[model samples]
Target: MSLRMATDADVPAIAALMRASVRAIFPRFYDAEQTAGAEIHIAHLDRAMVDDGTYYVHEDGGEVVACGGWSRRARLYTGSGDRDDDARLLDPATEPARVRAMFVRGDHTRRGLGRAILEASERAAGAEGFTRLVLMATLPGVPLYTAFGFAEVRRVDVTLPDGIVLAGVEMERPVTAGRTRCPPGRP
Candidate 1:
């Protein structure tokens, strides 16, 4: 029941956790294909790790039971709708960050790990010198973001590389000094 940074050895378990989180969180809001593709996001995580991005995992008895991560320099993509200037990455005037993705295994749900992950992400981002954090919220992730002080900036359609499309929301939170609000966005 302690959280630590993710190591390369944790990749496979992280992938399984991501898959489980997606399945558990999306049953009420997404089609099978859309929900299924959520797990594929895990494949991109190696780059995040290599970039020195912060990835936290909750381990119990040497096993990763829950996890989350965030990228100080996150990915931005052109998609199916308008973008808020605030949602834009690489803004010179703001120290921006993206909570690219985050998930906890299904069996570990309702035990405070998700909240722990979120707060850890906020701390990591804030400590890394970011003033604001952004994330694309999925149907099941909206409430969690809101609970972490992330306000909805806009809802848009994202076109994945494989031409898969999904409805998602852009949310932002101003990282105040000394506050750890939620898990990683990439979280």
Candidate 2:
């Protein structure tokens, strides 16, 4: 497996992977309408992350298997209605870097892809002087974020454009360099 920075050319494949992941994994935690809303609103490509050089894509055997990123911009997550300051830059000293869109292929879970991506994101954000990382994680993603040291700040219900409410967790973690190491015998 190889983890590398994502480029504009990878958007189509990344978007497809995001949708597939949501469709495959969301059913366990959400109803059909919520799942569909998530697929439409949550499973999207944030081109700004790519342009800002904060997104990453992981490939296994030459196929993209996972994608995620961190951003220093004001946007907390995608698919939420944009705020007036959404495009503004954040101060790393005061604001935690936003851990943006993360999606692993439906067939690629339990392989450490998510962990690897988080590791890269933490290191990069830390290097840029960010002291913490924050994310609004879907229910399916909360376990992974928790395992990676993120703690829940609150539960959120995002109302999609179609008026469906998708539950999510707001999570945060400190950006500790080299802190992504797994425990003994763990993958």
Cα-based RMSD of the predictions, in order?
5.7, 2.1
| Model number with the top lDDT | 2
Off by over 4 Å in 2: 181-187
Local distance difference test scores for all models: 0.68, 0.91
Which residue pairs does candidate 2 place in steric collision?
Answer: none
Alpha carbon deviation, residue 133, candidate 2 (Å)? 0.5
- Model 2's number of clashes is 0
TM-score of each: 0.79, 0.95
Q: Residue 142 of model 1: what lDDT?
A: 79
Least accurate 10 contiguous residues by lDDT in model 1: 77-86
List, residue by residue over 115-161, the lDDT tens digit for candidate 1: 77777777777776788888877767777778777889999877665
Candidate 1 residues lying further than 4 Å off, grouped into runs, are 41-46, 50-53, 76-93, 180-187
Clash number for each model: 14, 0
